[model samples]
Target: MKTEGGADAAKRRAGERAAEEVEGGFVVGLGTGSTTAHAIEAIGRAVDDGLDVRGIPTSFQSRQLALEAGIPLTTLDAVEGIDLSIDGADQVVDDADAAAFGTLIKGGGAAHAREKFVDAAADRFVVVADPSKLAARLERPVPVEVLPDAHTVVADRVGDLGGEPTLRSAEGKDGPVVTDNGNLVLDCEFGPIDDPETLAARLSRVPGIVEHGIFVDLADTTYVGTDDGVEERQY
Candidate 1:
C-alpha cells in the first residue's frame, strides 16, 4: 500500500520505465492522461538528450503536451505504423495465462476513441499505471462514444444490455462532455465485466456507437509501479 503522494511518484516511475522502450527514429504514439503525461515529459527529456523520435499523439491534449515537451509530431496519415504506444489505463486485468492478452478500461479523460486507434496501429501497446489500477475484474463503467444525435438511442440500447448508462457531463459546462471526435460519451455501468471482448463486440454493433472504452486483447504488456519498484507483466 502507498500514500497519495507515494502513488503519484510510483506512476511517474512506471511512466519513466515505459519511456525506456523508445528508440531513436521510432514513431511513437503519445497517449492522454496523467500517467502518460509523465511518459511524455520523459520522452521530451530524451529528445533534448538527442533521442530523435516522432510522436503520433492520440488527442489534442497529448499533442499540446508533446509540443511543450519538445518532441516532434507526426500524423497517422504520415506514418505506416507506430513502433510503440504507452498509455494509462483506468483499470487493468491481467489474464492468468501469460500468453493471453489482458483487458483494459480507459477513457477517463474522454479520449479513448482516438487512443484506441493509435494504440491499435502500434507494433506494441504498453500500459503504464500505478498498482492501484490493477484489478481482478473490471468494475468501472465502460465509456461508449456515440454520435450526438444518437445518444438517446444508444443509452436505451446500453440499458438493454444490463448496464445503467449515464451521459458523461462536463464539469464546468452545462451540456454533456463532447469528445475530440465531436461525439457524446455514455458511461455504462456493467459491474465486474466477465467477458470484455464479447461486450466490446456487442457495443460495436450498436448503431451510432463509434467506439467503446473496453480495450480487449490490445495490450502487449503492462508496467505497474509499486512501493518496491516497477513491475512488468507481459500479455
Candidate 2:
C-alpha cells in the first residue's frame, strides 16, 4: 500500500479497516475515491494471500484501480447479489434518531450514479472516510447526473425546488464533466437539508435525472478515521 501521511494515512486506516470486513467468497462493490483506493489495495493483497472474492466496480476509475491491484472483476449481470460494499463519502452527518446517519453527500468524483446503484444493492454497506468529511449537517453541493439534452431543464427544475444548480466542468479542460455513463453533472446547493428524503424524492422525479448525491438510510455503518485511530460508528 502506498499509504501517505496525514489525512491520507487516516483514510488508509479507515479504508483498510473496512477491507477487513471482507470474507471469502464475498462479492464486493468497490466504490471510487482516494480513500476507497486503499480498501481496494488491501483487498487485492488479501486476494494475493488466497482470499476468494470478486468485485463490481462503481465506476471506470474503480474498475481500473481494481485491475491494477489484482482484484478480480465481475459484473452485476453475472452476480446474484453483492455481499458487501466499501465506499467513501463527500460528507457524513450524525443523526441522533435514524437507522442510518442523517445525511450523506457523495459524487465529488461524479460517479454517484453508479456508486448509488452498487452501494444500495449490497447486503452490507460500509462507509470509510477521514475525519474531514464529517459534518454537523450536510451542506455540500449535491451532484445530479442527467442527459446532456436535459441539463437546462434539470437546472431550472432544481432552481424551482430551491437549489442553486451549476453545471460541473471538467478539470483542466473545457466543456462539462461527463460521467462514465456519458451524462453531465449538476452540482446543486440546497443549504442544510432538514428533509433529505423529500429532497431526494424531488430530485429523482426530475426528468432525465440519472442519479443524485443525497444518500439516506443506505449506509449500514460508517468508519471515520482520525489521527489517533479509526473510529467506527454504527447506525
Candidate 3:
C-alpha cells in the first residue's frame, strides 16, 4: 500500500460502481481530492453514457472539474435528497474481526464542511480510499478550516489541545488557500487522534472555526483498493 496509482484506480473503480448503482435523474454530491477526482471522472463517464444526473460540488475546484466533465450542476437548495455521495478520506479504519466499516476521518482538502453538508443531505455516503489508509486504530492529524481573521485566535485555542496548527497552503500561492466558503484552512496536527468524534465536536465548537476536516460516522459504505483487489465495507 505504498504510494502508487492503485489507490486512485481503486477510487475510480468504486466511483464507477457507485455511479452504476444510482437511479435516474438523481442528485449527486461530489467531493474533493485526488481520489475523488477519479470518482468525478467516473461520473462524467456515466453522464456520457446517458445517465440523468445533477451534481453538487463541495469545493470551487471540484465545481469547475464537474462542469468541465459536462456534469449538470445544481445547488443543494434546489435539490431535496442526494441519491448518493462519492468521496475520499484521509484515513479509514476497518475492524474485519468485528465486521465493521464506515469509521473514517476526512477533510484532507479542507472541504469537510461542505462534504459533511452534502453527506448529511444525501441518502447514502460512500468513501473511497486505498488499503494503506486503513489502520488498526484510526489516527491522523485532523484538519480545521477557519476564518483567516481568526487564525491567531484558533491557533491559541489549538495549542490548548496540545496540537500544533499550521496554515494550509498550495504551492506558488501566497497566504493560505481560502475555501469556497471564503475560510482559511489550518492543518491541526494533534498526532494520533484517540477520539475522532469528540475531537471533531470540540474543534467545530471553537469560534471563527468555519469547519474542520473531521467526519464522524457519516459514511454508509467504503471501498478500499488494494494490490490484491478491492475490498468493500458497509456500516
Q: Find the candidate with the highest lDDT and give its number.
A: 2
lDDT per residue (tens digit) for residues 94-138 in model 3? 765632245677777778889989987889888878777787656
Give the poorly placed runs of model 3, Cα more than 4 Å off.
1-5, 96-101
Error of 3 at 118 (Å): 0.7
Candidate 1, run of 10 with poorest lDDT: 93-102
- Check candidate 1 and list the clashing pairs: none
The TM-score of predicted model 2 comes to 0.96
Look at candidate 2 and give me any clashing residue pairs: none
Instruction: Select the stronger candidate by TM-score from 2 and 3.
Output: 2
lDDT tens readout by residue for model 1, 73-131: 99999988899999999999865652224799999999999999999999999999998
Per-candidate Cα lDDT values, in order, are 0.91, 0.92, 0.79
lDDT of 3 at 47: 90
Worst 10 residues of 3 by lDDT: 95-104
Cα deviation of 208 in candidate 3 (Å)?
1.1
- Local error of candidate 3 at residue 111 (angstroms): 1.5
